[model samples]
Target: MKGNDHLITAKAPGKLYIAGEYAVVETGYPSIIVALDQFVTVEISRSKSFGSIVSKQYREDSVFWRRQGDQMILDNRDNTFNYIISAIRLTEEYAQTLGRRMAVYDLRVNSDLDSPNGKKYGLGSSAAVTVATVKALCEFYQIPLTKSKLFKLSAIAHLDVQGNGSLGDVAASVYGGWIAYQSFDRNWLMAAHRQQSLTELVDQPWPNLTITQLTPPENLRLIIGWTGSPASTSHLVDKVAISKSRQHETYNQFLIDSKRCLNDLIDGFKNGSLSTIQAGIQKNREILKRLADFSKVQIETPTLKKMCDIAVAHSAAAKSSGAGGGDCGIVVIDKNQNIKSLIKRWEENGITRLSLRVHPVIDLAKETK
Candidate 1:
């Protein structure tokens, strides 16, 4: 696909949160995210007339759009393609600034992040698809972009549609592997986007945003267990935001505690201390539980709790992964730990252990045309 200049293809890996779920939504808060093996792939090819967007995940539905000046007017009423449309609009806007000509193209997406039954696994598919769409469009338009520019463009597109998220998933998708991420100020970006050019915004430093790749301890093993339920990350984040507005002091403390916990977890990775890493996971779980209790939100469901308990019984540290209302739980244990018993227990309790590995970093330098 890289050698094919006529067709542009891009794959963005899904992500799972290791720590700092709710707190990471706030500006300047840090989180740890890992890019998963599963991905959402986007492929773009030139079209004769109007462009159509189709996805394998949504077999029956497709979106037809034609450019009117700079805006893409969707011909259909279905809103499932909003993220893709947003990505295209933003990417083309950036491309136009480079004096590139826009051409009609057919875009198709195939995702492996969901279950065969169309059940979402809470693996950040939306973010992955958005990043993939942006990357594909950039390539199709012959716009050279660094990984950072790609991330910013993708994040901007996602925020335009979703309006809420930490975009840690976007960072993980862009820079794959394990990453320690600090969220940028969306408020600042929104304001800047209105006043500044798209190219200028991508080139400028986004305040409070920082991404650093981290090398996990060689002995550390990551396990993901699904609760067979789907979670709405945006809805959960909105609920937490409302809760934060009501309980100012408590939310502030949570932000501080999450930062400290993430720092310790990153240090664990740096020092190769499996014990410290496990301890950090445990602490983060406790903090999330407390936040759930006070916010009156179900961050961790009963099934997730059972899964975590089962992992602990097997001497592993476990916690709910994303905006967990019951989707997936992550376990961090030493490589030497026997996980067979844990898997068996999870299976007995209706938890499905997912077979996924961390995706390695992508070389963005090669993306240049």
Candidate 2:
């Protein structure tokens, strides 16, 4: 595979939710997300007979696929490669619309978002992989995809497989760095996809969707701690949606409060106020706790509680990351704040501290080529 005359490689970074968890799913509601240094990379090279996909994360379960008219037909029903397969199908369709030639290619995927033992860190691998695949294929076909186009295509592919997600992670993967993101109206996009060309659908402005890069305060220090337990974000989100349907009034208020809290947090970033940012995180944590009690869902486990408490005790702000029934907890402190004791306490309670920094944004002028 390495000896191929032309090999196109692309990597997309993993992400963590800084704030606005359950609320961000709704159209127009915003959340803060940061792309981490870890990534999922995809490599594509010409294949003689048929296209195949191999993922290091999936071990022995490789997928053999071929084109059936305009569709990708996988040899097996293994769901592990659904995200990658969907990306290939959508990107190829888009390429065909632009009169770009399509051909068989062998695709390889590698990820650094999970542990060596295959334990997930809940770092949004699916989103990263989908983004990387779209990026790689666009380059392979010489499509000259922009970052925004890359994001739109990746989101469509991911949603086609997963069926649901706020797609904040998709935005982070495409844009990189810290961003304030609001999800677009998925219903509208689906409707437009049926009526418009793939190229037209991607170029049009998505209703209510916005992604803005944020500049963190100079003194900010983000700390990530893994609880050694993986959580299913889709399952947790499904349960919350069910509870929300039964308790509309309570859920509505949660949305309102969450929007206000995150606004302050975004403002803190704009004003370079570390104290305001910490306060906003503290408030959001309390709001999530109330939401959990009413919905009877455990967004924060006992282990996560211990982690947050330790951070608060040390004068920092902490909360469960993503849809946390388990997995990672995030803490925000001033760079000047002494956190050695806070880390010691977390280690004593069996939490593993993760050393991850923010991935910077890509220059769109250079990236599009």
Candidate 3:
């Protein structure tokens, strides 16, 4: 794709939240997120035809295409196709503003995330696709969109697809680091603050960490367990927002406790305090239970609770990582524990487990071209 001067390619990966899920929607709370090894890739090439952007999807050796300016169409078959259109439309608008000639292009998008049985692992695959598509368009059209700007643009695209959403997921996918996100009211005051301060916040360098010097921990494992049911994070978040607007004391208390748990986890990671980290996970689970009604009927299921109980029985600290309902759970194992044996035990119980180890946060804008 690179050999063709007119074509451009870019890729961005999905992400998992290390901490701060529902709490991030609050004004003062901060969220921590990291990009996963899994990614979605986009390739864009010039088309000789004018005013005709053609979009394609590639999955499992199958390919399909859709034409631009047609009725707003969404292929129920391909999730990545929706985001490709968003990226192209955003890129085209920006190009128009710069007085650049608009040329039709062919876009090819591929995703590594699995979609079997209509099940998703809640790993931010949609955000990854949006970021990758935007990056490809920025490169292909020679439009200068900074990482933060790209993140903001991708958030708009996300809202177009999902109705309403926090940009934290897209920010994590693009920036690839521990991010502290605060959802400000989209009022003039908050918008002004965002416009004035976002760049500075993103530009600030990550703190130095001693973990980079040590060999990645062999026993440190993350087990992502899926609950077959799916829940809408946007709806849950909006409900919570409405509850907050009504000044519900119970909801406000949950937010406070969530923030406290998140801060403790961040501090634990900083000091390498495994005990504190485990304690924070435990507290976070408790807070989730207290706020059960916010999530409607999607509280952690009996099966997931039993799994967490088993992990705890084995001395492993576990908690739900994303919007609670039935998405996924993250378990952090101790350094001295045998992760393989633990995973085997999980599999015996019909729980799927994936190994994930934490790494130093990478600043993508500075680290990559």
Candidate 4:
């Protein structure tokens, strides 16, 4: 193989959920996710020798990276960029283990998400950056990293940064389509007995269905409302774990119902059945209410709930996308509805609205330079 010395850049978009959140973390649940137009970009150029991966951002100053080895490195100065470095190191190691030469390149990353702009919309900026890094590295090294492998590797990097993370975000980033994910015991994370238990679950394949992207009717609209408060998703997940440990039946039931509702929503999406979608969204909201009361308590801020109420009043299906404690909400507008009027009302109430057109699953390999 000829070693090509060239610069390659790649971008990966952020995502939002149509259904399933907490349930997606538990086993036997399906979650639906769509890639948003917002994205993160990585620029990779050949270098004389491996030194450090330098990173720069709008809100932060230039930060130099650290080297771990020809395979791995650590950059603790910036928590946000550390995961990107970690993914690059791991990908390099994987390539070497297979008797391939790893590319030595310098990378520059930039994100256009609203997180740093004081908006802090929870749109998986971290996962998007990780996806971009992995894509860029694969291109530079000429490594054939499959989408599934990319999802698994990115999930590991996410856990490294957030302690524990659901695969939903990374799956959405790498696959660029709707996905349903559940946490099963992997040998890497499981103890002897737990590993055995996970084997039983792993024996059965995870059930996932990708939603078909539909052409939006002229009146259909998507409104993204910012709640004006930053959410700590990791903290909320930990809280749920603790609550489940106490054998809270109500919380457990919410998780179960969430799984069911998510499946229904997936079916609705696949069949283009809006009625089923509407019903599933309503059921999902009910389950979220129960979970919010039991597990997160203050998970939904007053402003967010009010926004949901407004959308419901307008015959729209709406809910908070992620570990909801005041982040962003997704509203599905009816084709016969007045989208402009709804946007006007939201803006008048200080909520930011964004228009998005859904498309088919993105081809991640095509994104490689």
Candidate 1 accuracy as TM-score: 0.97
lDDT score for candidate 4 against the true structure: 0.67
- Assess every candidate by TM-score: 0.97, 0.97, 0.78, 0.85
lDDT by residue for model 2 over 1-369, one digit each (tens)?
123348878899999999999999999988999999999999999988798899987867899988776667788776588899889989999999999777888999999999999999999999999999999888888887788899999999999988877999999999999999999999998899899999998998999999999999999999999999999999989989999999999999999999999999999999999999999999999999988998899999999999999999999999999998999999999899788999999999999999999999866556534
**Where does model 2 exceed 4 Å of error?**
1-5, 68-70, 364-369
Per-residue alpha-carbon lDDT of model 3 for 153-242, expressed as tens digits?
A: 676566567755555678767766445455443343234434654334224332221011112234455567665556667777676667
For model 1, name the residue pairs that clash: none
Please count the clashing residue pairs in each candidate, in the order shown. 0, 0, 0, 2
Question: What's the distance in Å from true for residue 264, model 4?
Answer: 1.6
Task: Quantify how close model 4 is to the true structure by its C-alpha RMSD in Å.
Answer: 4.2
Candidate order, lDDT descending: 2, 1, 4, 3
lDDT of each residue in 300-352, candidate 4, tens digit only: 67777877888888889888878888788888776776677667777777777
Model 4 scores a TM of: 0.85
Off by over 4 Å in 3: 1-4, 50-81, 116-118, 188-220, 239-247, 293-297, 355-369
lDDT of 4 at 261: 83
lDDT of each: 0.91, 0.92, 0.62, 0.67
* Residue pairs in candidate 4 whose N, alpha carbon or C atoms collide under 3 angstroms: 31-180, 68-73
